[model samples]
Target: MAGVAVAAIPDDIAETHKGIVQLFSSTDDQRSVRESGQAIAALDESTKARHLEMQQSIKELTGVTNRMLDELNDRKSNLLDPTTKRELLAQKSRAEDNIRRMQEDNASLQNQVGALSNKATDLTTSEQQIKQREINEVKRAKHTISLYANISSIKWDYSSPNVKGWITAGAASTGRMRAFEMERGSHSDFQVVNHLWNLMDSV
Candidate 1:
């Protein structure tokens, strides 16, 4: 058996495969993925800190409100001065207002945290999809390479004495005489053409 000139893969396909490999294997893509993870971690930490701070503020305000209530209750049986009572009531109202404002701030903070969390989730999903696409492209490149390798590895028996007889028989059986002729015409090397003819005849 003799080897024939192998057809190379098309330029466009080769370029596409090269591009896919470069895009997935590049350091930039890796760095971007890492950055996304770091950003998510930072967001989580910020959210936790905000939550803890809000809780602490609410706790302190609640304590002050409770103290004022206790004082009001203690003075209820006594002849409390009107000014002192009004002052205590005003202080209580201010504390309650501060608590209400803090609660609203906490609610807004939670919404921001949720939005950041959703963004992180979307980033993660997009990264996974990109990885999947890279995997698929690699598979396609390998398959194309394998297919071309198989096509290029085809061998023919050019030196065999029975080649002509086999070709006639193959043509009669397969009705592919025209295809054989075209293949023969495509080759510049006479030996390669003979080998191809022999190979086709045997097929």
Candidate 2:
């Protein structure tokens, strides 16, 4: 039966078996990782641009406020009538109000920039976490594939029909098989077991 089953495998399938294994072993998270990196970079660029824009706005507003204060000082020092002095006082009050409003706006912009920076930091951290998870998953997959390869290499001597003898022959072999079984059963998603079964079925 085993010989017949082996014979039943198509030549094309046997030829491509290694390719199929490679396909299954390839990490699916690579594209996600790349996309996450790109997103993070774009976000960082956007944050930087916004910060620069805020800084420019603050600089320009400060220059305008300074010029207004200088003009007020010059007017206060000049010889002026009562009506002109009252107008100067009103102008000063308006300028003070404008400066206070600009200060509030500057503070708000600073807060917004801070929030954007924090958000970018969070995204970067999340990306790093995702990469770490992918690395761990790849390691697990490699270990599982190695275990499967070891299990497949064990020869069964059906002619003598000594299952217990075969199992007991090597402690290392038994340990590896037990470890493989335990690993297979420990998956929460059952995806690893299903993947292994699929690989076996294809073989």
lDDT of each: 0.60, 0.60
**Model 1: per-residue lDDT, tens digit, 137-176?**
6567446534533553332244543222223333236543
The local distance difference test score of model 2 is 0.60
Error of 2 at 168 (Å): 24
Per-residue lDDT of candidate 2, residues 1-203 (tens digit): 01111124357754565454455447586665566556655765686677667667777787888899999987777636687788889999999999999999999999999999999999999999999997898678657755755665433243442221111224444333312233432454356546445544443
Top model number, TM-score: 2
Residue 112 of model 2, lDDT score: 100
- Candidate 1: list runs displaced more than 4 Å: 1-79, 151-203
**Residue 77's lDDT in candidate 2:** 72
Full-model lDDT, candidate 1: 0.60
Error of 1 at 193 (Å): 27
